[model samples]
Target: MQDNSLPVDIDRRPGATILSPRGDVDMSRAPSFRERVREAQAGRPARLVIDMGAVEYMDSSGLATLVEAMRNARTEGVELVLCALNPRVKAIFEIARLHQFFRIVPTVADAVEA
Candidate 1:
């Protein structure tokens, strides 16, 4: 794992590709995050998981980026999953009712299995 200030770290597994982003994901970092998501999608993996364990904060732009990524993944027939969301971040998704749209799991292992 890297300790850089930047958002994403791409990790490839046997059947899934994980995008782990650290720190707050706001407007300033959402574009970069989106680009990374696109790159992961380009790989055409059977599954794509956004490991949000390191994310302490997220804004509407970040949520928008995720929504866009989900759309792209669906269009390409990729299964997009999210795991390890912090409490605040999880609450945001719940409040937005995005949990209905996303397959959110509590851990990376759960995401991989799902």
Candidate 2:
């Protein structure tokens, strides 16, 4: 179990905003994670990229939070992208068949361009 105490980092790019949540995104951190995503969405950037490079683990709650964010992005007409997902986290998305629904990329640069 990785540390869940680390705060989510939000970065504002030219045409996009990146939300980097470190550590495991479990039930305990899901609310905060959702809030971070909402905050990024509030800015109404053309692209909102979630950098999951440092996330080692994520449970159903985390998945739900992401789904909610995706729905919100859709309603707001914001392009939500995910990037740098580790194998473990990526496998979860694959298993859930959510990778097809999301704009998943291998790098932040790719996500930004996508």
RMSD of 2: 2.5
Residue-level lDDT of model 1, residues 21-76, one tens digit each, is 98889887787888888899999999999999999999888899999989998999
Q: Which stretches of candidate 2 lie over 4 Å from their true place?
A: 1-6
lDDT accuracy of residue 97 in candidate 1: 88
User: For residues 1-114, what per-residue lDDT tens digits would candidate 2 score against the true structure?
Assistant: 855454788889898898889888988888888888888899999989999988999988888988998999999999999999989998898889888888889998888888
Per candidate, the number of residue pairs that clash is 0, 0
lDDT of 2 at 77: 93
TM-score of each candidate?
0.92, 0.92
List the RMSD of every prediction in angstroms. Answer: 3.4, 2.5
Native-referenced Cα lDDT, model 1: 0.90
Superposition error at 40 for model 2 (Å):
0.9
lDDT scores for all predictions? 0.90, 0.88
